[model samples]
Target: MSARDSATVRIDASDTLRFNALMPGELQERARMRARPDFPWVARQAAITLSEAYRGNLLLTRLLNDRGRVALALLMLDMHFEQPDAPGLTTGRLKAEAVALDICSPGRVGAILAAFRLFGLVAPAPDLDGRRRRLVVTERLLAIHRERWRTILQSLALVLPEEGERGLHHIEDPAFLAAFVHALLEPMRAGWRPAFDVPAIAHFADRDGGMLIAFALFGTGPTGQPLSISQLARSFRISRSHVVGIVQNAAEAGLVRRVDEQGSRGPGVLPQPALTEALEAFVALVLVRQAVAVRRGLAAIGVA
Candidate 1:
């Protein structure tokens, strides 16, 4: 179903209260700073989407690493913007794009390429380029790359119809709005810079690894009250098992502790002070990039 069709229902007061409560103080602060007045709603929706999508990343999270994911994006961009980039992707071209985008270093790019090649995502190009060794693109990633953007666009659409005038015009212009939304979300994701250097357990990664971490560390009520597992699941529409596993995993990793009878409502998940500090550093990195992107976007349209 179209996002418009799916989100046609009005957001109930209870849902509004719950969702707003889910937003961390830090994220709310960033939204206040970066959200365009013309489209103040975009910042909140985008933040929610980023958290949701990053958490919703089931397959891709396990299939690719941080840099490998970038490499895959570079390959698809070749198909997207440049001509003659179809049917195949090359390390040299991927390297240039990666460097231009500041996604990774040349050495890291090489490793990414090698990893993709090792998997079946890429293959040796035809005999024509024997010396240079270009790589052919596989159908394996096409549906994934295309669908992800489609999903993002639909998510934005569900929000664009919201009570915001600034973004309304762009919504009419699909191309413009797509670019605009992309600009808004990219920094949020890239700035997050994925927490794990190594992949989590297959099942955990299959679910929402990033979401788990965020909840494990920052899941709380609007007034900073710790929420019980049932409360967290109810508010987020996440499964109880998922919440349990996430908390258990975080505890295993020493990122948080489950304190029995900790909060007025019920048992609460408390952050390990040392780990919370480290996680905040990651948030700081993303916030800086998001702020810059928001500024550039506003400036582009001659808005303050």
Candidate 2:
């Protein structure tokens, strides 16, 4: 299979596993409910509740997919804070709490903890006595929570036309959303530098060749401006054909856009404002996927 096909297969398998892990017994029920015509209204109510909690700076909004799991996780955190003397309240303790709360099996808690830690939603740290480790909420945790909540609210408002009784007063500004998306893309963006070889793309091209092409074409260009296809090819030692193909794909995916379009003879350019909005939405979706993937990956590895 092609590299892209392989990635697709892997992602599909991962998604299936994730869905199964999240609601093993309730999938059919959930699907049935969601298929109902009034499901959007239900989702809107849930979104409003979640958004309110997020606006209040509640830490529980960080966990996606399962509300029960989030509640259990927060309860575990609270339990740690209230009963420092409680045994089995370590990372292990949180997992046990999740199980007690019927969020997941006792054996699955470790995986859940790992998933939360991977995304910076929670951090493993030494307790006050410095003897055992405990989970502490991180700033990124709150940021992700707030972002997801906003996305949920926006999605609900968009999906449920009748549910828009009032607008959120503290909705995130476009600039904030753009910055959040940029932050999430940091790893992908940093990999485009010349000095650092992106091993992740090695399956597609030679060492540093992929980075060179990506940087010139996708990375900031002349005077820190976005580069055009022809200019990118000249800098990367690649053919215009290759550069054109890559740029086209990136443009289609809403990643890169042509800056100067008046004199252009190629595909139409993406406007700055539209690109920014698309990137923000892409980042929000990615964050949710990553959170769910981490949770599932951990469970598959028997960590949870």
| Most TM-score-accurate candidate | 1
lDDT per residue, candidate 2, 1-304, as tens digits?
Answer: 2323222222345545654564354335334445657554444344334334433232332244232344444444344334346553476666655554344566657766677777676776666667677666666755564555455545444433322212122323323322333333333222221012112232222221333333223212223445555654444455677656655554454445655563554433332333333323322333233333333333433433
Candidate closest to the true structure, highest lDDT: 1
Model 1 lDDT per residue over 1-304, tens place: 2211221234456644553453335345444434435332333344344445544454454445233354446444443333453434567766776666545677867876676566666677564656666666565554454444444344334433221233433333324333444454453234322332112221133243334435334423123555477765654556778677767766676656787785466666676654443433333334433333334444556655
Clashes of each: 1, 7
Q: After superposing candidate 1 on the true structure, give the runs of residues whose Cα lies further than 4 Å from its correct spot.
A: 1-59, 64-68, 79-81, 85-88, 96-102, 161-304
Q: TM-scores, in order shown?
A: 0.41, 0.30
lDDT of each: 0.46, 0.41
Error of 2 at 230 (Å): 36
In candidate 1, what residue range of length 10 has the lowest lDDT sum?
Answer: 196-205
